[model samples]
Target: MLSAVAGAVRFVMVAIMTVVTFITPFLGKKEGKIERKAEECKAAFAAISDTHLTDSFIRLGMFEFGLQDMAEATDRLDALVINGDITDHGYPEHWQAFTDTLLKYDISDNNIMVLGNHDTWGGDRTGDYTKENFIKYSKEATGREIDNVYFTAEINGYPVIVLGSQSDHTGPTFYQDQLDWFAEEMEKASEKGLPIFVFCHQPFNGTHGLPYNWEMEKDADPTEGGIGEHSDYILNICNQYKNVIFISGHVHAGLSNTEDGTNYSSVEKVGNVTSVNLPSYEYFDVLRHGHMVNGTGFVFEVYDGEILLRARNFATGTWLENYDVTIEIEK
Candidate 1:
């Protein structure tokens, strides 16, 4: 009877943790423990992920606070990089909705976007859209022609590479062509003796804190998460480089909890590469504990020796307070 009772208690705890993980974002409680800095720095850029813009004006309002904060923080914003998922669905109308809203805030020509799976593939989990369509709507919205899905842009004299899958689907597919292109870009950046800043919609395989890490086992399906088939090839390229800061999103993981064993901080440094996973800017269930609230992203301030990632909720115009993290840049 005692053994059975203990087992039942264990089951109940697991159930509670699961519920908390999903529902914590809706809890609406402020994170009070972390310190908030009012000062703004130079040579900083803001990055966000998983906008998942739909036709709802109510959902669109979430961007107001973040935009306002950026305007107030910096007059000449170096670049505002939207990691991916600009549209909830791969519909022209949905993409237009995102473009319309961003225009209201005047999200500048410096805005850099990396295509998310949902942006290329329809939200119905159907592979209905094409890469051409994504580029079309993107060009129409940004007024800039995207020659390739994966390309590099210079921000503050630093080379930042934006990577996306060539195929239009809601999964990470690194074709040999794309891999070759990446290697070529990395070589060029390496020749300049500059640290490469790479942004992709999907996180690399085996990255902790990302949702992909859970299913990256020996036989797990590739579409579920992570790089999947060419995981080794991708990582090999990253490892070959001396300084590669790879940023990604797609997990929609929350940023509040970093204590529990399974709950990891958004930042993880492996070898020469440091991977930072941005939490969802939309409503999605998170890992371990706490769901992420809307308008959650970091204002990355890169200094000579260190980079500070300041977490904030643009919706609320408040800093995550406790989640400000610092990473060293090898000089």
Candidate 2:
């Protein structure tokens, strides 16, 4: 009788344990696979930033994507955001080669392109590479004509504005000047009640090494200008705006967080004015290169009212980051 009772107790205990285990997962809120994938595919992008290199097919091998990876991401991504550096000095042939590859891409109107200093062979003031010229080449490659050195667009129904890469990294461009124009556009969109996304090559309030101009003399203070070389000016201006998501390139800058026992820059900060800094497309950079290598781009998942930010490593085919971020215009 004792043996039989022990066996019955063990059976009952095992049944209780199995029941608890099966139902425990449902006790708390969990994101379903469909919802998770919806976030991933919503704005999945393979953004390569900085890429200040001359042109070469072999050098581009490090583009984070060869033929296979390119084809895969192409199928799922909403678009690609080439933050800047389309070419190494407005070399027509070089740009042609890069565009040739881009032409083969399965991008759509949703894909937004921003010009970098390397793209302009000459600065914006010189008119060497005017909006017309840049848009002309862009049209030839993607059949879309980009107008204005600074303009805004929508991606997967998210706000994204394309600002030209500065002609001279020497001084600040008074990017604030563009705010009036930017505000005008935002007002129109605001009337309609839509979100806004902003992207540029340089940081707004630069105060760092790459974007900062040293005194040419020793221990001299950096000329107050761009965000990367300065501090708070740009961030303050941006903070004043509403429904704005800022994304930037240049400075080889990044935002970092610790995960699984590793320290990494998952977000790009241009002198503390937070934004996404895309990595370089250059196969090799002979000049002031990464204080940190393995640069990547941001994948912004924009759902209704809420946007999820993710930093994806193209090399590993995994997301190194995931964050719930908010960027909305004030009513």
Candidate 3:
């Protein structure tokens, strides 16, 4: 009788653990499959930023629009580009949710998402954060080997570079490294007449030739004087290569507007290459993230070498701007 009781207890415990492991993380994702029976194709693709998801919620505001974006993209786009913040924090529930999501979606694992503010930094105990762990989670979840190997991928025929903020350094110094690396890459692109697009976590500069700051100062550049010492090298590099496009989130303003030749407005500099900023869909507290009104990301459609942006209109499903200008790749 004693042996039987012990056996039964052990069996129950094993079953409970198994169920918890498998059954959880079935949240945050709607059931769907890629539109194409085989696969989809397109010339270049749309840039997707700030997914900000993990598993638990049944439904949310941007769910349908995101799905629609995927469907449209799969139908017309050859690949997808994500600008980072893949996990909210690396909680068990969020990680599990993220793992099961890719497994279920049957989505392509070639997506490029950057590590953003939402992801925890080193020594961040509660968030389960750290680039190594984040890399591990992504590799395990998506079944893809990540490194400089996958950073530069060719979608369709165009080349896409996805930059990360959590490498060697997560602070302002990264900007300097990013500038050097970007300049080398841009040199090659310029020689080949190829255009490079940058998707980062923070904006390069604030609107009106200032930085998006923490204190709302008179003359602050988020890239320079906001939190950490701003990276002076980044703007210098971009000034030389104004043709390069920079798109980002964490500012919640539409595309940035700056006279410092850093922020490229779609309206002001529509023809010449421009830089853009995106809005955070999840958190939008005025005097905090935004004024609670305008808070959405910018999406870009690249054709030939011309990149066009779609403003923030989640309701109409016209998220990223459509391609308008024609690109001439001089061979």
Candidate 4:
């Protein structure tokens, strides 16, 4: 009888916790403030990812509309970065749809995109998910020749490094050559005494409170998700830098905290690197606030001493108040 009662108590506790997790977002709302300390000492940008654009006309239409709203909202954005997963499937049609939507909005020139696992058919889907096609469609949509998926560019005079995986799509993998390139880039930025913004499609594994399934199945390879074979190498390289803002996506988790009160879905810091996981612009098994309000993205405003990340739903013109985060920029 004692053992049975103990088991029953445990079950009840789990059930109660689950209920609380689902309702917490409604109980308290968090808001972020944007205070400009200096006019010349700051820049602003916007980011959203995991669009998973499909070939459906309805879906494409919705995305098109959302793009319009996003553009209108961030009219003064210094840069607009679309992190990855531009298409749901590695299909030519899906890519075309995504391109069409961006072109229609006249926001193509403002975007800097990367490739996600979905674009490479890293999941169960199969197709000609080649780098050639990725660049081809990307250029068609943006009207810029992208010879390399990974490159560095200056955003408001800041050295920003963009990274893409050439292997192991779902989880992330950086070949030795890629790692070498990253190290060189970081060295260059460090030598200049400049803060760097690193953008990738996958978040770092294990550090953000993401579950094991995020990287791989429980029984599958232990090294997947954000913690792939080259995670340590990449992270170690990043840690060597002083101020590195690494942003990623792919996990379509919601913008709310999980049942354990962990908001691994948003901003987190490990070592000298601050990692940001942008919430999906589409719908998925959202752990926060049930589902996203569509057209969800973040606006980053940099000040003299800190950065403010404010989450907003362009489709609805409202902010996810509780999801705001402020990171102090290290001197």
Candidate 5:
């Protein structure tokens, strides 16, 4: 009973905070702008994660700011990748809000939706029901027919592959079949000799300060805050390829500079793959280690043989220049 009461109070607080955030633009909050250097790139995309949209208009309004900023930034986004955790509880109402928001913004017709654990968490329905809803809405967003949660797309001639867990869990679980598919897809994507963009909701087990980064628990298991048993298997597949850029979310760890001597930065290179863990697009009080500024994500620009990642806080319309990184795509 106490826990239920605490949850109720927390919800009320969050609702109030959402309202305040929603109206910040009208209250003299200086909106940051993203300057897309279009002439300097071959392909570019905006990647964000953990929107966690619910049925509330205020929360949806908060999300709308990001989309609005992106639309205003570029004439046309080559693609927009929402890495995962799209809905708060995987309920119909939650998804309806997301669909409505997408319709309101003419941001990108090439919107790519990836599955997060929360998107499969059906509050009162079975997991399969929620997964089906994901497929339905994903088609609505991307205009592509997809039967499975994981799929691939070619955006501006660049290979973009999205991965998802077969089951709903805090940490993702990958079955053998999905693992096999991923390997095959990687092989095909690698043949182009261009930077392959991969999106997953959860990071690998130890990258980006996992376990400690997930819950701030010093003694947690290595896999506590990442992809579960198949973590190494996925890493191995990435290692086999050159110029693979892996992006993920779920930890909600904020942006940090590499000089911080912590693995919690927004970007890291594991083997042949460049790993990027995005900050949660919405604010949650559970974040630790500072840098929890909400509305944070990255814009990836592919050059001849290098990929430049620029960090931005879309909510306030600001650029996080300190977290910007440039990675050389291995030839």
Candidate 6:
């Protein structure tokens, strides 16, 4: 009887927290309006990662704010890619909350959500069940017939390919079949002579301050914070293609440059592939190092022979001018 009473009290406390988190955003001061920075933009999109929404209200408020900001940023967004970790755990209620929150805003209908490790970490279900849930919600959100977790979409005639881990692990695991499919997809997309945008939840091995950057340790394992055994395979495939911009978001690293100018930058290039690592979009207190600014993400604008990437703190509706980057694309 005593244990039951304690459980009831805990539930009540959680309920109160959830209610507060949902309402706090409405009461907070609204940030300045967001406007498109690119003129004559052929295609534009916003990318954010590591939302980490859960069944409770931990990051829901922040995610809601982010959606609101993005919705108001421009008149039309070709796409809004949530790179991964859409849920803290793969639970039905968690996804329900995410969809419910999305319905409250005017975010782009062309939403591309990648599957993160946290989305598959729910211990209550089998891996198949978790993937099925992902497919269901993805279809609901994008209005596409998604047979697998990994799929492709086209935004304003630009090819966008998304990759996902076949198994549920801390890092991504790509089997041979998926690798072959990726190669085929790359070949097809490259033939168009346009910049190919690839979205994955995990970064390639050692590109974005891996191992050490994973936990900020200098002597960490080489593969501690990257795609596991298949990292090299994916890297090789990406190298074979020109103008491949790979984006990922599992590290939760900050957008600040490192002191030694080595690891932890938001952007890096390996061979022909340019990798853009997104900071975790959760609350600020959850981050450990670097710029702990929460609600940070990227705005990608495609122009005639160049792609502009501007970092923005959506929570504050401010652009991070120092981190702006431009990539030249060969037509």
Which candidate number has the best lDDT? Answer: 5
lDDT for position 151 in model 6: 84
Give all candidates' CA lDDT scores. Answer: 0.69, 0.50, 0.46, 0.68, 0.80, 0.79
Would you estimate the TM-scores of all the predictions? 0.80, 0.67, 0.63, 0.79, 0.90, 0.87
lDDT of 4 by residue, 232-329 (tens): 78889999987788988877665644533654547777888988887777543433443344456787777767778877664454566577778887
Q: Which of candidates 2 and 3 reaches a greater TM-score?
A: 2
Q: Compare the candidates by TM-score and give the number of the best one.
A: 5
Task: Report the Cα lDDT for residue 159, model 4.
Answer: 83
Q: Which 10-residue window of candidate 3 scores lowest in summed lDDT? A: 33-42
lDDT (10s digit) by residue, model 1, range 1-331 = 9999999987976666445434434455444322223344435678889878788654566655556566655444677888888778667788778777776665445778788877876644432344666667667766657776777887776778888876655566667778888888888887766667899888776665433444535465544566556766777888888667888888777564465344566778766788888878765443346434556888777766677888877555567757777877776
* Model 6: CA > 4 A from native: 1-32, 123-125, 258-263, 283-289
lDDT of 1: 0.69
lDDT, candidate 3, 103-150, per-residue tens? 443334455555566555334532224555656766666554665311
Report the C-alpha displacement of residue 29, candidate 6, in angstroms: 8.4
Q: Is candidate 4 or candidate 5 better by lDDT?
A: 5
lDDT of 5 at 128: 65
Residue lDDT tens for model 6, 257-294: 65434346788788889999998887342234455566
Report the poorest 10 consecutive residues by lDDT, candidate 1: 31-40
Candidate 3 residue 120 C-alpha distance from true site, Å = 3.3
Question: Would you list the rank order by lDDT, best first?
Answer: 5, 6, 1, 4, 2, 3
Ranking by TM-score: 5, 6, 1, 4, 2, 3
